[model samples]
Target: MDEMLSVRQLMKTYGKGCPACLDLTGPDHGRNMCPVCGTIVACADVSLDVYPGEVLGIVGESGSGKSTLVKTLYFDEEPTAGEFYLRSYEDGVPNLYDLSSRKKRWVRNHQMGMVYQNPHLGLRLDHSAGGNIAEKLLMAGNYHVGSIRERAVQLLEKTDIPITRMDDLPRYFSGGMQQRVQISKAMANNPPLLLLDEVTTGLDVSVQANVLDLIREIQRELGVSMIVVSHDFSVIRMLTNRTIVMKNGRIVEQGLTDQIMEDPQHAYTQLLINSLL
Candidate 1:
């Protein structure tokens, strides 16, 4: 099966970097900051492939760079070095990081969707729920107001947001409802790939379950590939087919979610699993 998304040697740094940055920082070194250059490597030499209809989970503790990996994939942050390819975009031929800004925007709107950890980042709280969905459609070049509204309503329904509240601002809804609206907006374009970053964090446990159920339902129904980032292993186990364990700024282990859960090879991965037990 062709990969829905492919990334290689993806790296993100937060300061003027030196050659020593990659060598001196990572799980092996127990840190991600370079003492010689004062650079912080958020992620380095990260690579992965997401197959069509697959849900890939990235799990790590705070500052483990799991979130950074997804953020860079979504173009929320610029990677210092990387090659990104999407099968839907030019048959995954060209490196996306080298694309022009306009082309990148087009890819973002037409090929990929992102649901941020913070609702505020993904939704305009003041805009009506439907309006947020329409904004996404608009970016994807859908201009028919009637069709946009229809699509928005359909997505809201799919995400379990009431059609009656379509005209209501997300701010007026509960935290879970706000996330539902964000999901609706993210899926508005029906992109081939979706990036979700700590989506269930900061929500009530029951609410998180509901949201996770919704996400699983969407994936089952739509067959859209997804990369889900979280520090919660239970969430990873619940939603992902494959899992990647990250530490400092590098991947420590990756395998089938069940296999990794049963037999984690890396010490960091074992430590993570033990914490859940």
Candidate 2:
């Protein structure tokens, strides 16, 4: 099967870097900061492939760079070095990072969708629920007001948001409802790939279950490829077919979720699983 998304040697570093940055920082070195140059490596030499209809999970502790990897993929953060390819974009030939800003915006609006951990980042809380969805649609070049409204209704229904509350501002809704609205807006364009970053964090347990169920349902029904980043292993086990374990700005292990859960090869991965037990 063709990969829906491919990333190679993706690196994101903060501060002025030096030659020893890569050699001095990582799980092996027990840190991701270059003491010599005061550069922080957010992620380095990260690579992955997401096939059509696959849900790939990235799990790690705080500052593990899992979130940074996804943020770079969604274009919310720029990578210092990387090659990104999306099958829906020019048949995955040209590197997306090299594309012009206008073309990158087109790709972001038309070929991919992102649901941020913070609804504030994903939705314009000032806009009404339907209006937020319409904003995404507009960016994707859909202009018919009637059509936009109709699409919004469908998306809201799909995400389990009430059609009656279409005009309500997301800021006024409960946390769960706000996230639902963000999901609706993200899916408004029906993009081929979706990036979710710590999406269920900071929610009530029952509400988190409901939201996870909704996401699983959407993936099952739509067959949209997704990259889900979370520090929670249970979340990864529940929603992902494959998993990538990251540490100190580098991937330590990656494989089938079940296999990795049963037999983690890396010491860091084993430590993580033990914590869950």
Candidate 3:
């Protein structure tokens, strides 16, 4: 499979005691949670590949660095030291963690997008649903604002959000609806990679099923490679071909979704699978 994003020997740290901190100036020392002292070293020396047209599910308990790993992959957090590559077009490649602020803005505008755990954290709560979706594109300089409302409406409809509510504030929407709005915002630029962090975290099982189905359908339509961070094995099985099991901030086992589910090698993996039974 072709690689869309690759992380090799990547390391990140925070705090004053890390080896990385010795080698380089630490992050603002006043802040205890710096990305330079091995704060998330559970991901140290980690390497993985996300392929085109595939969904890679990352499952782990909270505080295991699953969020941090996803963020770093998308350049949301800079690695203390390592080599990585994001396959962009003819330009050959781009180091996601090393782009200049100006260049990084370009990638953030179009090729990369994230669906956060908290919809409010990623959306403009003050804006209407359509405006929230269109705002991201406008920031990306997507000039067709004339048609953006139309585009936003299509997304609202596709995500099962009623077209009648396009002009409503996010605060007025239910949790599930707000999540759908986040999905629509993420797809605004038709990004190649989407980082879905517990996208269905707060929804009911009934609504989770619907939202997951919607995500799968959209990924198929867009040919987007998704890295979904969720602890739900059923969601992983339903949405991803491959599985990565994280524990204490590191990948303990990874393989085909079914294989890992049916015949896990690691004890922790077995525990996870058993919980489902």
Predicted candidate 1 versus true structure: per-residue lDDT over 88-141, tens digit per residue: 888889999999999999999999888888999999999999999999999999
The best-first sequence of candidates by lDDT reads 2, 1, 3
- Model 3 lDDT at residue 150: 80
- Index of the highest-lDDT prediction: 2
Number of backbone-clashing residue pairs for each candidate, in the order shown:
0, 0, 7
- Note the residue pairs that clash in candidate 1: none
What CA root-mean-square deviation does each model show from the true structure?
0.9, 0.8, 4.9
Task: Let me know the TM-score candidate 1 reaches against the reference structure.
Answer: 0.98
Model 2's TM-score against the true structure: 0.99
**What is the alpha-carbon lDDT for the whole of candidate 3?**
0.79
Q: What tens-digit string does per-residue lDDT give for candidate 2 at 85-170? A: 99998889999999988999999999988998999999999999999999999999999999999999999999889899999999
TM-score of each: 0.98, 0.99, 0.89
Q: Which candidate would rank higher by TM-score, 2 or 3?
A: 2
Worst 10 residues of 3 by lDDT: 23-32
Deviation in angstroms for 128 in model 1? Answer: 0.6
Model 3 regions lying over 4 Å from their true place = 19-42, 89-92
